[model samples]
Target: MSMAAPAFNLRTDLDAMWLLPSLKPRIANQLAGLVNTAPAWMKNERPLVSFSFDDVAKSAAHSGARLLAEHGATGTFYVSGSLVGTHSDYWINADRDDIVELIRSGHEIGCHTHGHLSIANATPERIFAETRTNTRFLRTLEPDLKIDNFAYPFGRASPGLKKRLATRFHSSRSTRAEVNHGRIDLQLLSAFPLMDRKMTPRVIDRILDRAVQTNGWAIFYTNDVALQPSPYGCSPALLAYALTAAEARGIECAPIRDALLKIGAERTF
Candidate 1:
């Protein structure tokens, strides 16, 4: 199946984007972790876990929020202001009303850039520019909204860019698959997908078990939720199942914003 093309043209270098193009940012991410860290003093607490939905697909706005709320938890929605109410290569984006509903229902709104631009594909100037546009656009939707978190588009960020983001948001999430534990870097908090392409129930169960054993933080991200989801998304049933399993394990489920507070990191904005 052909993917739906994004409305805006991507300006990434096609040559540098070959064979694990994300590796460039991944390396920079590792280096950034060494310096300019927002250390989380996550001690004497139950294992923490957060569910985040990127792009805020229509299905995610509906089924994703419903499932989390049913479990008495809320997921973070990392939105691209420019993509709202549009059809993407994956799924139809969430509309303005859905954004309002999510805020009203207690879900978080994190920045994902104005046009969902991949950090690997954008220059430092464009990165800052896009970030500003994303925040400004989201505020236009609701004047008093507080966006204190961000997710790197395509799970990529340069060292310089990561340093800049660290001062701006409470936390910046990445797509690296690792459990966050003991003196972790808040700027590039690690997370992995819950989609079929990357994970299975048994795999997620083990991830939850590890978090429980270590008193660590397990952050999982996804895109859409429906009977048929995109490659970057999971089915509604899988989402519900993951939540149920986490709850069954007695994991403390909270949105990224709330979970950060519990670990002794305060939102700067």
Candidate 2:
């Protein structure tokens, strides 16, 4: 990494191009290519950076997951039980075979929810039920693995609900973008949400330099990859920028959960 890289200005909001019919596949491939070129050591490290996608969508199956496999990078897919087979959700095209393929590809399978809901309104018991049900269903798919990772639907959770989730799940996520504090709160893990093509290469370079300066972890969450008609996917050019930025900095990119795991569990206060 060189000092020549400029300061990056971070922003929220996915690109609107994902909603378009064309340019989807191309962008998807770029996402795959980004992952396919990753370094090996970063794939297994303490405080490593990795990619994860929430809400099973076609872009996840066709674009995002593909790109992750290309780079030999593994991501955790948190899917809602109800949406697994439904064809109606924005990008949750539960390709049964693809879901199996993702598992076979060495990716982690986590739960999003039985149905998408914000824990803001639900009681702690309700939150626990939601997470438990999804995890139970996911177990049928892969009996040997433990369901450790969870993402709060809509990034909503209360303190009480957080406690319940922490007791049951290893980690949870929200839209907050920063490095993990190396803790296991299971409620407020920082995440960078992906929307259309707003995240560009130049933008990614800026973030990596900042993270290096701070020595903090950054985890990016996306709904899908380069699938067409995307209202929340980044383009290939942009996806590669972020991935390459990590590579350029000599920082290995890895799955978010694995990164923290290598650091050991965070103590509960």
Best-fitting candidate, scored by lDDT: 1
Provide TM-scores for the models.
0.88, 0.75
lDDT of 2 by residue, 1-269 (tens): 65777655343223556434345433442342233121121222423556777778766766676666666677778888777777754555666667777787788777787776654345568767887788777777777766677787766645555566666666667665666543323346666765555565565666667656655466777775763546666654445556666766766666656765554545332
Q: Candidates' lDDT values, in order?
A: 0.85, 0.62
1-269: candidate 1 lDDT, tens digit per residue? 99998765344543355335667656665676566456666763788889999988999999999989889999899999988999999799999999999999989999998988865677656876888899899988889999999998888766777767776788999888988887777888889698977789999999999999888899999998878888999998788888889889999999999989888875434
- CA lDDT of 248 in candidate 1? 92
lDDT value for candidate 1? 0.85
What's the TM for model 2? 0.75
Mark the regions of model 1 whose C-alpha exceeds 4 Å error after superposition: 1-30, 33-36, 266-269
Off by over 4 Å in 2: 1-47, 181-186, 227-229, 266-269
What is the lDDT, from 0 to 100, of the residue 259 in candidate 2? 63
Tell how far residue 133 is off in model 2, in angstroms.
Answer: 1.1
